[model samples]
Target: MGETRREMKQSESLQASLPEDIALKIASFLPVGDLCALGSCSRFWREFCGSDVLWESLTRQRWPSLNFSTESSSVDHGDSSSLEGWRDLYVKWHAKMPEAMLVVQHVNQCAVSGSLDIRDFLKAIKHLNSMGLGFKDVEMFLLRPEVNVLLNLVGLHYCVHCLKVPAEHVMEALRNSKISQREVCVKWWNLGRLLFNGFGMRDESHCRLVSLQDLALPQDNQVLAVIHRGQFTRSFASRYPYSILLVLPGLSRSSQVCD
Candidate 1:
């Protein structure tokens, strides 16, 4: 029985004595939450899991566009302590994401209600810019059908028109009110009348048509056209000098044009 007990101890010791490289390899595969939890097991693990290499990998994976460097000329040449700068940076940026998401959600809600204050919208844009995310990074959420419609109403057709504008220039334009909503609408009206007699709608499979009344446009504002879903026919195109055209497939031929 004593010999068996001794053999069991030897097996346990062999398992615990894995090479450092192999141990690190195994730990590297753990998710961030699991790794942080594992770190609480002991001092050895806390230092191992919090090492610069692992955290740098995590930070880079989370925010690929973020350019971060941990190298510092000011650090003592021979003082090699486990660097935790990357871990701290990752934690800081992770905490900031929730706040940024909330700001974006608030802006989306305001846009849907047609009560989007230009100043507030610009402020949100500026805030997101400060976080190092460009329009392309967040375009997936920003270019949703509902959000795109609101953007058009505000004269910022991000997907179609504002793709080439630099981020700084966009912020400056927003700050200076360079894009007037009324002027943009008028331009669309003129384009429809002169070129094709119809405003180009986004190539989406489905869209919910919003009326001027539903949008709560000011009473003084004049709507040049109201478009409905249907096939785009030559007669319908020529019927109105200016029209908002929706080209939806599999929909009925019924359409309406509001002068």
Candidate 2:
């Protein structure tokens, strides 16, 4: 009888020591909101979900379909007070992202085009910084001819777009350039009817070059839609399977991108 009890104890102990796969399987069925609950079960679970691959994969699984849109202005979009609502929602979503896969799910596998505003873009940068996330690639399509465009495009730092992503943000997150470790295909968004001349921007106003290294436009509209909507898919294929043309924004249209 004592031997039977000892064997049962050993069986339970072995289950406790099972490999990470079983634990991950259990975690997979959980909602993004409840991931932390699963992670709290054991140290292994915490490390498992915290990974970029795991979290990124989780993100693709949850928000399988997405749309990326912006309000044109206070009146067209909503009242000024709604800015607070936007900020609050962004903060809430950003906070929940770290807890699970919500943020990455929302951001990755996107081909952001059209005008993006600076203020909201900055908010996005703050969220990325908070969550330690990076983009696959970004292109800063210059749509306007205003001087604020320069200020707005200044934030075009980390990825492919030569616009308003903050260089300071990039320098601060120097180690954040995980993309460099891997080789990515050249990418360009819809540039038709848009004359962006920041490519030669070597003046004191511009610290970085606006040129593209392997800039190839997307040919397929499906992929462009993916980029257009800021939605990622489970399939991140190689060979630049997509070359597309779509309307996206410049760094100055910061409000559009960030909101």
Please name the candidate that would achieve the greatest lDDT relative to the true structure.
Answer: 1
TM-score for every candidate vs. truth? 0.43, 0.22
Model 2 per-residue lDDT tens digits across residues 1-259: 9999898777657756978787677766765568767666555566665543445455433322222134212212345555433223333434544432332232222333322322333344444445433332221111112212221122233232322233344332222432211111213333234338645433121011122111212232232233334332211232322322122333332233222
Model 1 RMSD vs true structure: 14.2
Clashes of each: 0, 36
CA shift of 36, model 1, Å: 0.6
Error of 2 at 84 (Å): 29
Q: Kindly list the per-residue Cα lDDT of model 1 for residues 1-259, writing each as its tens digit.
A: 9999898777656746877788688779988889999788656577778876787788776565556654422223255563336676667667666554655566666644333444444455555556654333343344223333434332233311223344344344433432222121111221233337566655322222343222223332233222211122121234332223332233342333212
Model 1 worst lDDT window (10 residues): 182-191
Q: Best-fitting candidate, measured by TM-score?
A: 1
Error of 1 at 91 (Å): 2.2
